[model samples]
Target chain A: MSAPPTPPDPTSDAAMTRRSFLRGTAAFGGLTALAASLAPLRELSDFSSTEQFLQKYYKEMTPSDMAKVIARIEREVQHQYGVRPHVRDLKPMDGVEFVYCLNLTRCIGCRKCVHACVAENNQSRNPEIQYIRVLKMPHGSMDVEKGDHNYKDAQVPDKGFFYMPVQCQQCKNPPCVKVCPVNATWQEKDGITVIDYDWCIGCRYCEAACPYFARRFNFTKPEIPKDRLNPEMAYLGNRPRKMGVMEKCHFCIQRTRAGKYPACLEVCPVGARKFGNILDPESEVSHILREKRVFIQLKEEMGTSPRFYYYFDK
Target chain B: MDPRPTRPGNSKSSRTNLWLGGLTVGFLGLAGLFLAGTRSPRPARADIPPVDKKFLETTPWRQTYADLVKAKEDLSDYDCYGCHEKNKPPPIRFDDKGKIIIPKEHANIVMGHGSHDRNDLCYNCHNEQNLETLQVRDGRQVKFDNIPLLCGSCHGPTLRDWDAGAHGRTSGFWDRKLGEAQRLSCANCHNPHSPRIPPREPAPGPHTLHETTPPAQPGH
Candidate 1:
């Protein structure tokens, strides 16, 4: 569609030689600078190729493959923490759909559950990663925006205000799992949304997608003391996460799988937290759902279908 | 081959006798060792306090609830029957303004129930005849552990909620097949005399993402 180029003039040969020499020098200089800057990236190349890139989709892996992967993770944790962790891949229990109910009237605004969760989950201590965030809301109001999360009161159950502790709702239709680009997060059969730390590319798409603000991104390597490190861990739950990953409460998978309550439920001083399988009619959570005026957070037309419920006595 | 070598003292019976003697010596040696082991002293006991029987029966998670009763027992020095058995105290004593007067014995008690105007008399909850146990609307005696029955007569809705797992703290297994569930008594959380829970220090709240200062507000 365009015209052909004209022939080069014989007299411009010297100019052409000089132009090529300058271009060559500039290209060489750029390459040298790039190699210097990228020197640190070479160390991370092994992690990318061996772990992240090679990780198959969770559903694609066979049982034998999962065992090998769990073994490798156990070795890596032992090397990093100098502690032999019991990393297990616990499947969902049959006929067990976990649900949690919190009594708003009895919660004394005690943050014991927060600290207990951190200790049990092996959360970063210095950066202070906690799953449960108790909001202090005023009396006769359910608006979380009007609530103060950083209240430092001399006494709790303050005359005109009440406390509402919020955490992962463990929604049946979790937005966090839906938004994971690499399928790094998914809901287990037992109604817990779990994250595969090594597979996550730290895109933070799930963090943005979560309606409950439940997902937490590991901006840096989680710093926990050697003494405080919880040796008990789960492959898809509370195992030590690498830097640049996403994690949230998995309902204490390590303990709950062993037929024990979550650390938060056990540590609550007022026994406000109630946890049980919703499948059983005789469960405390079932009783609460059937009898109490149970309510969920962000119960709009969004329809996340959360498992967490809050109720108060008349 | 040995048919002709049979002798009276050096027969096969002599070899069998030697084996039996060795077995007898080994058995006696083992018996002596066992007797020596049993003579050793047992390990010394640690100076730990006696564990409460209630705590031992209940799960460890419910130990805090058990501690509430233990703490009350530690402080309850005044016996209710000490004066009630010997001397007859006035059941109701009102001043000229019809305000309830605190007797010398109950002057230390703080009555902070907000609705004191309607039911201010002590006999409303405590039995005038028997001061040890609480009384219900139908004049039925209820133990301290069964205070919910007495409280339910007046607070029918609250009692219903409590039974339905809507009110009070229930600790232990949700499944009855796994373990026993322990519901805390009313007196575990609230003071019986005052009823109103006093204000206490709240645990530290959540640290915000940016650590921004909370907006200044009235009555914070």
Candidate 2:
């Protein structure tokens, strides 16, 4: 430099006043405190924002994009659970419209199906998320309100009660899919309603809209023991769901898409549960609906057109 | 020939030996042909029980209940023939009041079958001579596996429902191409004696934030 520039005079008309100087200092200090206070929020934003913003809607994603996302999820699950999860994006089988039938007369009020669902779905163990709820109803009543779910009996089919187990109806006219603001949930070709865990904004609109009370929300980061985490996970079904997302029974999509029965159907000791493709006339569900006097749950007014049917021998 | 000085009986003996050998081989060939033509019936010795032809002919309805199919208690273990082999014991003995008295060995069993006390007798279902086999109303012996036919004779509607895959459980596969669908037999779910399904402890109920009780009214 040619020479040191002469300093400006403090008393000059253009110079800062003492009030202005103090105001500047205070403003700088306030901004510093805010940045420090919001440090955790910034960390959260960094962790989620990039991946979440990049995530495309489930139906909008291409095959390669879905593969990449599945691989990423596999890595994340492995990092968290210390177990390598087989996360797959299985499409629905052709000409398959699945239906479930529960025989109210045969149901012994045993909840083996409930436990089997939890285990197969890799639900949160600490918070205890279960998809199936068996209601102990009075012998003559079909009212769900009068039914007690918390009945602790020495044996089931209580002396004067009949057991009814309820789960996701997998409706053809699903209200939950309609109310999702983010389009996180939709009906698959096989008539299964599935939610994309990553895309859900945690608004719980679908949870509120569900008539059967089938949806579950992940309020906190779900904690599952390493040993208890089901490694065979489906991308849109039983994969390790993150915090602030919604989940429900997807009819064990991981297993069912591979031509296996749902966990609930497999575990029913009394042979009370039945599942099959409704499109086929010879399928068990179709046979039950055709021959037996089968009725859908809550079919009076709310026409969800549920695939689940409850029937007894006439 | 003259030089050899053969004995006069040599030619006759050779012919006799040849005939004997031919007869032995022909007998063995005939026995082999008989065995090949007909399957040898299982030996019906006194020590070995006779094969139940009815049992061999009957095919059991597919059992879908895995638990019942895998049940530990097997009928063979009971050995019904153990006591009934030599003694043709009467199926039931009546007291002076005409009440059926179970024999000492069967005292532990409770008989609550449908109208069994009045209209039915043990011989109606149980074969009189062969206690191991069940009998249809027409007196045809039915195997244990074909118990549905015996039950179907009375429960026509239920059998129809069972056949149509409405009343009982069908497990395994929806698509027959993928796997076999098994329909459960009556004995799989119901006790043949009591025929009524009993209750058992349920699995843990749902753990929702709110219980399943009806929501409280605003004023209440």
Candidate 3:
């Protein structure tokens, strides 16, 4: 639509001569080529695959590849939660492995550990969001691998009963990490497996894949009172999650990162918990494990390379 | 969201996956819990050693009998033979009605019966013949003061719960008035013959809680 201006009529001899001389050369192909290139406008519709088109978490994608994912995540959170939080790309701290152990022998049937985990994790108010279940075991039983969590209140023994608590095993070869199609759940360098909540599609593949019965599905929206919420938090582990994703005990990652023991470990009154790095043989847990027979959870089979160890003193 | 998350190419069958994923996993979880709650099955019941039935028979050797008889002697219908005796005194067995009773000197001795672990060997602390000068703590040489030390032997578990401010002989020391503090004998809180945890009080409804049925009035 933009046309080149025509030469104005010359009012004087000098202008006429200039215009006439200029028109003499323009009368050739020189002017038309400029108009054709500018007028050849075309629209291209991109039909790349959804994976290629969606730039997701930088953790899931390289920095150059994550733009679309980050933007979409921001938009989704804004639309659904009315607030957009920064979706962080966290790498596990180096030379550290977040390990957990439960002293099943000493655990009482008091559900203090479960409650402590809830307060520490800032888990959604839904009871299903619970990361721990203290299985009320009968007295003189050591096989926690065989322990199940079907206990109702009546199962709490009025006399002669012990308890065993179970949670995420946090395996080295986490089956959940293997099954995530988008690699949303990953094992950090520190041996903690975390989910990129932003990248999670709520596929629940993680729940199906985990062999330990650890992960849980958040089928409903999470609602929590503001005051009850643990203000101190982390993105990969304990941050309150939305509906339609799988969550489980994160080993109290927020607390562990700061060199504090898990809340569940601290609240256990019976001294039923021991936590340390397996790599460091000098660590108290490692020493206890070396001195006493420290059996990995579910030691019989299904070797997931779990770091959690438990044993009873005779 | 998993309208069709399962793919035909995924090597595991969805049926197997569904079973392994849920029902199998849930069943295993249930099986594990059951295992934890049950007694070990390997130990054969027949292997248990036979109990010496006579070890639990009654006698007159127990020193506490003096306290029961002397302190509450006027109280009629006390079942000394039932709670403290099982067989008869050493020389006696069946009475006129074919019932067991204490015989003369052996009438005061407790051979054993029912939770003897908590009640056995009463004379070890008590003076079997002497009922007057009771042995007690503070070297009181009275029968009562010795109870704190006597009961502390096996009852240390509960007594420890008390010392650590957990269990036993709870006092009203808090109110300092109505909740005043006092130490009572283990007998005051728990009847040695039959001890039971008090049932939680039910919601106040129409339940007379009378002794009409009266637990069949256990016999000596």
* Winning candidate number (DockQ): 2
**Model 2: per-residue lDDT, tens digit, A100-125?**
88888788877777877877798876
lDDT of 2 by residue, B71-135 (tens): 65444534687666645756577789776677787866566677644533678677877777788
- For model 1, what is the alpha-carbon lDDT of residue B118? 48
The most accurate candidate by TM-score is 2
Error of 1 at B146 (Å): 2.5
Root-mean-square deviation of every model: 26.8, 34.9, 23.8
Residue-wise lDDT of candidate 3 within A1-314, one digit each (tens)?
99887555455454554324444434332333333333322110111235523544645467545545545544544454455545433455555676665555445455556666766676665433566666545555655544435443432333555666667888877788888998778887778887766567778888887776788776555555555556555666666676566778777776565555566665543445666555655444555565555555654377677767666543
Superposed Cα deviation of residue A56, candidate 2 (Å) = 2.4
Q: List chain A TM-scores, every candidate, in order.
A: 0.85, 0.87, 0.69
lDDT of 2 at B195: 67
lDDT at position A70, candidate 2: 83
Candidate 1 vs 2: which has more TM-score:
2
The alpha-carbon deviation from the true structure for residue B201 of candidate 2, after best TM-score superposition, in angstroms, is 1.3
What are the TM-scores, per candidate, against the unseen true structure? Answer: 0.71, 0.74, 0.45
In model 2, what is the error at residue A313, expressed in angstroms? 1.4
Decreasing DockQ order of the candidates? 2, 1, 3
Worst 10-residue lDDT window for candidate 3 chain A reads A40-49
DockQ of each: 0.09, 0.12, 0.01
